[model samples]
Target: MEQVPLNPSRYPTVDYEEVMNSDEGVRKWTDNIYRWGFSLVDGSPATPEATEKLLERIAFIRHTHYGGFWDFTSDLSMKDMAYTTQELGAHTDTTYFTEPAGLQMFHVLSHTGGSGGASLLVDGFAAAQTLYREDPDAYNSLKTVLVNAHASGNEDVCIQPAAPFPILSHHPVTKELCRVQWNIEDRAARMDVDAATLVKWYDAARKFNEVLKRESMERWFQLKPGSPMIFDNWRMLHGRSEFTGKRRVCGAYINRDDFISRYLLLNKGREEVLGKI
Candidate 1:
């Protein structure tokens, strides 16, 4: 089966109350992510504890240097740029990890005395597919070239993958596009390729970046109180616009394997779902 990019105008949004109270609602919410890569739960409580509980219902929270569940404001609380008022380019998180986070949730608690903090999402699968169809050379470069990424914001703490990985990854058996890892900020500068290959890689990567930033490939929305958004980190690249004022956000990362396991069990007996994995 082929994967089509989401219809931007039709992004799923289910009621939080429904999800918390009914099994069918939970299946709908998770199914939306399985089919479209993201979904939103409206009417959720806008608090760190509430967010944590909601995420636990879906999968286990992945703990990193920042802890399992986090509540932070744009006050430079951490060494990462996400702590400041700046425009973050669209990219996936935890690129430095050998197994990057599977899913991410974000619920904006408050944004006062500020203007723009719109959330941005670009379907990496769509962009990569376009690259594959239009420029095979560039697509192949990204799929084959191995690169490094890291997280060194904490004092005396720098973490990176045990080995370098490629930007585009496919399923081993199905040969279907499964994961995408392209973070300009987190990607390290080191490479082992020759000068010619390096030049080709950069050119290819630049082209892919252009595709990712195209207007048709991007979706911009303001994450509001009572609306918690969850997205497949492996397929969607997320970012935020430059913002002012105090913006507090609460969220957590759910392990990929745990999420898939939940998705599989919830949709059991459906061959279409069970056969894919």
Candidate 2:
């Protein structure tokens, strides 16, 4: 199905219980997530048990070198910006990995007394598609430009020296828009290309970013305590606002294949059950 980024007013919050217990709920949630790149889950508890059950309801957890589930609080030693008090612009996480986490979950266990700490989400795929439609040359340039991303350090090594990959890539089998990979924080500064193409690449990047920040495409909401959200990491770009006060978040990541598999299985099961009736 062709997906587009929509205003959150269209599909606000989804009930957590239905998604956990009802087959139809699973299908609808899957469809909504894939279509909109996100769904805010409000009916689930903000506990580890609830998060674990939610993952089980959809798909199993994806274990990486970062481990299964995460409990994050602001700290000086934070390797990632998600654990800091500073504001972040819209971007995908773990771009350094060869295949970054395809899905992300964030459970707000406690967000009391926090001001200016609301979370932001944007549809990166929508921005890319807009570029493709309006500026074909820039869109093609983005797909052709190869950039290096690194995620290794003293004790950990995922892809040493990084690997060169396109900012935009289509599925090999389906030849459909499969990945939109861009992370300014993780991007290697050494633009390993001729001057002319490098200029085009930057120009494309500017266009994409401009669309991503348009006010009409934004969804702003405060993540109060006990509200957990699950979103597609591949298609959506998320960010955070700077805040003062305590904020604790917990959740896990799931593989892209497993998510798609679960979605397919659930849809099939529903179809089969309905057909029998």
Best by TM-score: 1
Question: What is the per-residue lDDT of model 1 for residues 16-70, given as tens digits with 9 covering 90 to 100?
Answer: 8788887677778888888878898988988888888888888779999888898
Q: For every model shown, what is its TM-score relative to the native structure?
A: 0.94, 0.87
- Candidate 1 TM-score, true structure as reference: 0.94
Predicted model with the maximum lDDT = 1
Off by over 4 Å in 1: 1-9, 269-277
Overall local distance difference test of candidate 2:
0.77
Q: Tens-digit lDDT track for model 2 on 43-82?
A: 7877878877887777888876566887777774446677
| Sliding window of 10 residues with minimal summed lDDT for model 2 | 153-162
Q: After superposition, how far is residue 191 of candidate 2 from its true place, in Å?
A: 3.6
Whole-model lDDT per candidate: 0.88, 0.77
